[model samples]
Target: MKINRCGQAEALTKEMFQKVLGEIKNDSHRLIFALCWYTTERPSAILQLQVSDVYGSARVPLEKMVIAARTRKDKKTREVPIATALRQELKAYSAPSEGYLFPGRAGHLTFSAYDKGLRRVFEKLGLRGFSTYSTRRGSLTTLSRSGAGIRQIQALSGHASLGNLQRYIEVSDSEVAAIAAML
Candidate 1:
């Protein structure tokens, strides 16, 4: 269905995201989807993450920390403080050291694979106009509407410049209503 990562795709609603999340049965795939929704980082970055990056040899608290610079697109490290629920999910997965979190036949799950997997989920749901960027975009839009400053959103997004982050947020009509209601 030609789901482009550019601005062509609109941010998905939480319910819609959940529906897609629910459809993914594989534990690795579920974690990938959850991480996309939770971290708001690039899907490729999440896919490139090693087992040690997520969990060390021993258990640890889910602190706000940079998820290894190796996987980052900008090559600039960014920190995401994950939720307790997601932490538990990661812990439950029990990954081995020195390997990609979501491994496929060709080593790690490629961007195309992640994109295609998500595409299949969306197609099954009869959804249109969403892509790899949807979860990240949707999270940013939600944060903006919830009264988070642009910089705060940028913190999670790791947007290199101020102008770059603005592109991810699509202001909604309800946001206008929210402004009017606040008066």
Candidate 2:
């Protein structure tokens, strides 16, 4: 059997995801990381997110954030409900009332900057191939392995078809167990 090297990208377990989240010091960056894991948003779409996307108003309860059609790869808009716990964490963040979530020299953080930062952290932890894209891929794999239906996963990933979504998900050990148990 072929073994993945330290640098090769691998699907993450819940524990591994938590470890990475703890290591990241920046709240905005952490949110970005969490967003990628919690949903299948492309890095660019994440950078484009604004505070208004989440918190509707002090009076109105927070609701789902809409990923505008222009920002999505499929050119389809989706309203994603924010995780309740994540909402609390976001409430504590000190972002502007109106602006990009992670502003850089340009309007939003450059993809290079986000990638380089992630790579630096991955290298420090003596891991490889854990690029920015890995979060979404790992998340989808995780959801699938946990027995989430394919259609549900497809909804979150915004993948055009079942084939594309399946292409990225890895069969988890838990899934193997479940299948074997079925016999």
Q: Report the number of the highest-lDDT candidate.
A: 1
Q: Per-residue CA lDDT of candidate 2, range 36-140, in tens?
A: 777667788888776677666652326677777877777888788777756765676777666776788868888787777776777788666577777877888
In model 2, where do residues sit more than 4 Å from their true spots? 1-8, 58-61, 172-183
Q: Estimate TM-scores for all models.
A: 0.85, 0.85
- Candidate with top TM-score is 1
Looking at model 1, the pairs that clash are none
Off by over 4 Å in 1: 1-7, 59-62, 177-183
How much lDDT does each candidate structure score?
0.77, 0.74
RMSD of each: 2.7, 3.4
Supply the global lDDT for candidate 2: 0.74
Summing lDDT over every window of 10 consecutive residues in candidate 1, give the lowest-scoring window. 1-10
Candidate 1 local lDDT, residue 99: 78
Candidate 2: pairs in clash: 7-128
